[model samples]
Target: MAESLDTALVPAHVAVIMDGNGRWAQRRGLSRSEGHRAGTRTAKAIVTRARELGVRHLTLYTFSRENWSRPKDEVALIFDLLVEYMKGELANLLDQDIRLLVLGDFDGLPFVARQSLAHVMAKTAHCRAMTLNLALNYSGREEILRASRALAQKCAAGTLEPESLDEAAFAAELYTAGQPDPDLIIRTSGELRLSNYLLFQAAYAEFYFTDTLWPDFDAAELERALADYQRRQRRFGKTGEQVAE
Candidate 1:
């Protein structure tokens, strides 16, 4: 399926809101933990496929800040899975030349999880093929606020003038600073909302919503999304005729 895609149309950066893990498990009479576990496998497969398809950056909404409000046991399970994933995938990440990058407020994560993620990130830092970004403890609102605070601090210190700040300056202060904004953002399980993921970066992104559960979203599904994206004429606020000109 990927072979049929026009490589030129592939998004430079793809962001995914990996949803429906709990429902996937519930429907199968399994625990939410099981669903999350299955979702991790899908994540692994998608990362490999995305890299093969020439996506330079792939960001997964692994754990949101709001997710911490869930049951303690469920939250624990998620962190546990994260640790296991980092430990198990570090070698594969290095072997595939996929750099691991974490977005969001990572310092707020648990100690063991932070240690595991740090080790994997350090080990795979030199990989240049593609970047696999995981959004952990992430909140789009928080990210915006954090960046705003930094800018405010600079202004207070008289290092930056309020009137001199531009879009580039603001973006440089984001967690995704230096990375291309996602050209395509996908949400699985029919979710239509951004859920506070990449609010600033996704301002001009093409969104693809799928009913398929995260655990079931495969390479073929991704191909469909990319193919659809190719068919769209992104004018970026300009008229189609203007774009053609």
Candidate 2:
């Protein structure tokens, strides 16, 4: 399937909702933390494969604001894993020329984790090969609300007019301001919901769902998703005839 893919049809940006970690671990009689640990390995492999496949942007839904509701120990473990991954992968990220970008609320992160994330982001600022956006502590609704507040403040200060706001203008204030909207969004574990991920940006995206857990998703699964995306016809509301034109 990979061999027959039309490279030109590959989506420029791909987003993933890595789910089912707890279930994966439960099925194996391991702790949920173990599932998250295994998922990290899969994340690394997918990032490498995305770069190799010429995907310009790869956004992984690492952690969401809702995740904070989990048990304290579980949350701590997730952050710890994040710090460890950043510290361990900084060198490989630089060597591979992949820039690290974070989306969502950074202030909510633990101080040490925040420091580690900032360090890696700064160190890889010059990487131009591909962007790896980790959507940590992200919430699409919150993001939109934040952007709205910013715009509203500008308007209140007389520096901007409400009438002057356009889709592009509004989007510029978004967390994904400079990034292209995801062309394809893949969700593992057969989940069929967006779960507040890239809500604004996924307006026209093609979605692919798989029963495979995040801990087991690999390059082949990614290729299969891309292949599926390649078969889709994105009309962006245009009629099929108009699209053909």
Candidate 3:
């Protein structure tokens, strides 16, 4: 795998929308649960790879709020897998100095899942090498709405002024308040839409779509994404030529 992508343009954070696990399983005649389990293993490998590639933050869209619409059995399987993955990866996370954090609404999750998430987060809070943010039971639209409601409550209580709202103030209300916006967003299985993941944070993020399913993603794919990110000239609001000059 390629390494040392140009520091200037390489993404500081890479967020993934892991998709197509069900399709992958159906293709092979396996159960969706097995696909999810395989995807979890891929997640573990790529988190380590992201750290190796000098990515400071890696955010994974593990389970979206919308996922609850799926069959109840599938949803239960996902929650079970999350608990098991956290317990299994605890040692690896601590030994590798990777901080594990969860972003999203936990209010509706099963009690045991919530406890497991909290326990994992507490255990890895001190690791500084890299942060692996798992977006479990998360949705960007829901998050923004939650923040908006909080802001309104503050305004109603006279603690915040309605006229003082700005990007900075609004961002602080997000689930990822202290984290930098994702610089690159990866979606597997050739998906073309954001699927309501990180809508606010990925406003300017460069995207890399792959036909490979989430369960198949590995270190080489990550390196390719980083190398591709380095080759692009991100002008933000300006033309490429104007920004370069």
Give the alpha-carbon lDDT of every model: 0.93, 0.93, 0.87
Please list the residue runs of candidate 1 whose C-alpha ends up more than 4 Å from where it truly belongs after superposition.
241-245
> Model 3 off-target regions past 4 Å?
240-245
List RMSD in Å for every model shown: 1.5, 1.5, 2.0
Compared with the true structure, what per-residue lDDT tens digits does model 1 show for residues 1-245? 77779987788999999999999999999999899999999999999899989999999999999999999999999999999999988888888899999998989999999999999999998999999999999999999999999999999999999999999999999989999999999999998999999999999899999999999999999999999988888898987542431
lDDT by residue for model 2 over 61-149, one digit each (tens)?
A: 99999999999999999999999999999999999899999999999999999999999999999999899999999999999999999
TM-score to native of every candidate shown: 0.97, 0.97, 0.94
Instruction: Report the error of model 3 at residue 132, Å.
Output: 1.1
Q: How do the residues 25-74 of candidate 3 rate in per-residue lDDT, one tens digit apiece?
A: 99999999889989988998999888876788899999888888999999
The better-scoring model by lDDT among 1 and 3 is: 1
User: Candidate 2: what lDDT?
Assistant: 0.93
Model 2, clash count?
Answer: 0
